[model samples]
Target chain A: MLSKAVQKYCVDTLCIFAVFLFTTNVLAHGGATIENDRCVFRSQGYSIHFTAYQPSFSRTKELCRVVNSLSETIIVLDFVDEALRKLPVDLILKKQKDDQLYADYMLVDERIYPAGTMQLPMKKIEQGSYRLYVNIQELAHQHEVAENVHQIAGFFEFTVTDGAKEKDQSFLARSTWLFYLLALGIFIYLMALKYRS
Target chain B: MLNANVIKKLVLSFVLLTISTVLYAHGERNQEPFLRMKTLHWYDVEWSVKNEGTLKVNEEMTMKGRVHFFSRWPQVISKPDTVFLSVGTPGPVFIRKFSYLNEVPMIQSTGVETGKSYDFEVILKARLPGRHHVHPMFNVESAGGLVGPGIWVNIEGNADDFVYGVETRTGQTIENLGTYATANVYKWHAIWAAIAVLWLLWWIRRPLLIQRYLLVKDGQWSTLITLTDKKLAATMIIGIIGLLIYANGVTKEEYRYTIPLQGGKAEVDAVLNPDEGKVYVKNKKAEYYLPGRSVIIDAEITNNHNLPIQLGEFTSANLRFINHHVPAAVAALDEDYPDELVADSTLVVDDLRPIMPGETRRLHIDATDAAWEVERLSSLLNDPDSSYGALLFFYDSNGKRFISEIYGQILPTFVD
Candidate 1:
């Protein structure tokens, strides 16, 4: 009977561990997949190559979504299509709080970029979850004029944190601690049962 | 005489070897996303392989494309001050006959300006027999190789039967440049390998390390090297020098009219303006229906030309979707071109009527195909920014073609 109970306990623990592993795997590969070896952000029939850099903190490294440092962040959107250069586009930076979005920064006004490149220098941004939206001004105008027409735009989500310290508080990091505690608890319970026997 | 375990192990070994031989070609997806996206954007790439399904030895293929040096080049990589255009293939599988960028020969590295597109063409001849993936690539000065779309080509026949012949400027015909001086290379390598083996054996035959250290500690290190060893070393050094002098004399006598390899970049003229037709296309809205596997784009097209025009083709990321109704676009597909990239279903226009001269009309274009999903381009719907870009070709009544660019956000609809 004792051996059967131990087997049941082992199976239960393994099942829980599997669930944890599966959830973390999904989270890691959740947003923004690489296509043709490129991190492309598509806006209605057009695409832009999105890249971020924290030059003051990590000059040589190219960042995608996470900004490790609180320093001035440089975000560059490269137009993959020449047609995008002719359209007027704007960008908005918003922060998420309690499922509500609040505008944090007006990164760009509606303007045509002839060079096919838009560089946004962000400073004084607090640590939080933020969304950067690229709005095509022409499409936005059409949306306003027509009812039931959605605005044509694209957006990417990123998290700003206190570098390594905040990274340790992430779900994956905290789950690691939980995993160790669970294992230790199991080991201690087994030792107690062995002593009683 | 073999046991059951031995037979099992043999079977396992065979399976492993068979699996290893089924390797995939082109590891382009292994590169960092930033480098592939923000560096050089390749567009309108067209590859033509002669006898594509089974190209015989010595047959030729061509890859032509346009590469736009992205203006927003990544800061992590150095600027492409000097770039060399080359072909990417499994080592020496195909020999590059000629490579031209903007009609100028790309024998050496050349500087390119950002925000400009350069037309390039590369001709390659099959050398090895097997399946190979070929890509048009550019090697930046500091940055590594930036590759374009890769196409798989199959070569049949024996590799040994392949020959590359060339005619020198002095009107001398070299029978096979590929095998030229091959025997001399093997002879020199054998001679050097023999000398190295003799030298290694001479040292290995002697009591090494501890024995020599003990002699040194006893102040009898001089005994470690006998007079015979010194004489043999001197003789070996003299023999090497003599061989070098003899080889130099033989080479000078055999190739008296040798010319040094040409260096310096060839001057290429500025990129010519592509003849974009007077037709203009404005994207009203676009959506991709998931269940139907189709992309529906609504746009307003204006015809400024004197003749009425009809939509001919929609091309994106080297994939061509032709309008079957337009004979001109369908005729453009070469017989040797890969059929997998072309959509089986023709592009559908809501209104088949051609827009008259000086008339603007709203057109709904439906590009439906399993190719969108097969090419993995439909994954754009899952991307954070779901936008797409495509070139629309308009053909006039006289078969004159005009090009217009269309770009807009594409939303995915679950319900068709």
Candidate 2:
């Protein structure tokens, strides 16, 4: 039989472990995701196909399909740095007819509509650098069909200086696999500790 | 002396570190200044009983504390579009009565910036009594993300039977949560506070230590008296009283409560031109489920004017019209539209062609091979009054606008 002190120590450790697990459950909130990387941004003026994924030697046509479908997909974009976002800039979509297709203009300024692919043509914007932001408002309702209303939001880095080369769209791709892997590893370790104790 | 000073320094550092660690571990307190300042300061809260002396379960109104953002300092750098106003519930724990941000209905997701004061108020109906902390939360779309600070409010009961109705100042009855009652609840708290103070005082003043005396006996039966041991007794008595008083004060301050609502309402006229001519209306109802996600819409179209209206565009929210003018595209029993932007759910339109005068059509649209999931009910707080309902814009032969309202709930469902 263990001594009283040892048994007391074990009980204390178990209690602490239980509290930690309970708290972890509460703090681990859900998040949003974008399934693919290759996307197309189209408006009346231009339809540009941009690939944000690595071309693997392995056959991954299914992966490519996932990337292609993300063109019109809305994402929840958050500003990482406050100081960078405070810069005075505007995202202007210059109206141009690519292949002679007329585009309908939405009257709201600074608002990007993801109703259809390609941003509406921006007109008469002040010269500056800006990051484009797009988001869809997800509504709440009860019917089962209302579940797929994920609002597609997009962000693009643009500059308005004369003769400014449009910033590479590749700048938007981010690798969060490391963070996910770290979180998963920690989660597994915690689960193992919990089960063992 | 050097050693003693070193020891004192070590003890002081240890105490400071303990306090700092406690404060730092409390993440909820430091998140956002707005959240810290604008907690619903609930005081003098009361719940009145019904005719049978049993508490009225469904008819309780919670007047949350009036909350206002700090009007000065550290100006909110982002514009109104960056921030969002939100309430803290573990889930949709309470049916929101009427919530106003800065005295205006919080209809839009875009929120108020910093340095601008706002009063938020919500009369909540009685909900399930899980100890939930109600707090103010802000979401910045791109810049300065979520700032959430919370306060605790304990509730105890089941939530299913809760019902809320509103009675406007004009006596117009609209279903709403009950009003604020402060006096009754605070009375109980005040009584408890006084009792605690008394108990603390009584314990301290109850003669903690007995005085002793050592004396030489002058005679066998004669009582002998000598110098009393007052030094240790004095210190013990004073220390105990001081500790008790300090503890009582600390306890009173620890349970300090403050809950305020910082919101308001706005009444603005429509900026867009209203279509006054032909009232082309479509009242369509639809249900969406995640398994092979489908939109089953029960549709009805009505032409109120003498002239025939052609609905070339049958749109729901932001989804556009496809083959709406196609004559051969018959009124489908179940027609599915491509939702490329947001997959999994399909947009169902009743008829692609125009309806005749006073004609009603029913159509069902379903989308297969789409990956769909059930959305949370909390998003409804964004558009509470259903003012931004589904619209069907029709046109006359001359291209004048005819707007119709589609009435139905957009529900979230699960597949697995």
The numbered model that scores best in TM-score is 1
For model 2, residues B329-413, the per-residue Cα lDDT tens digits are 2232113222221222224344555555666555454322121111111122223322113344566555555555444554433
Off by over 4 Å in 2: A1-197, B1-267, B270-285, B289-291, B310-350, B365-389, B407-416
**Model 1 lDDT tens row, B220-333:** 989998998999999999999999999999999988889778777766654654654489899899987643557899999999888999998886654567888988777766
- The global C-alpha lDDT for each of the candidates, from Candidate 1 onward, is 0.72, 0.37
Score candidate 1 by TM-score against the native: 0.53
Q: Which prediction has the highest lDDT against the true structure?
A: 1
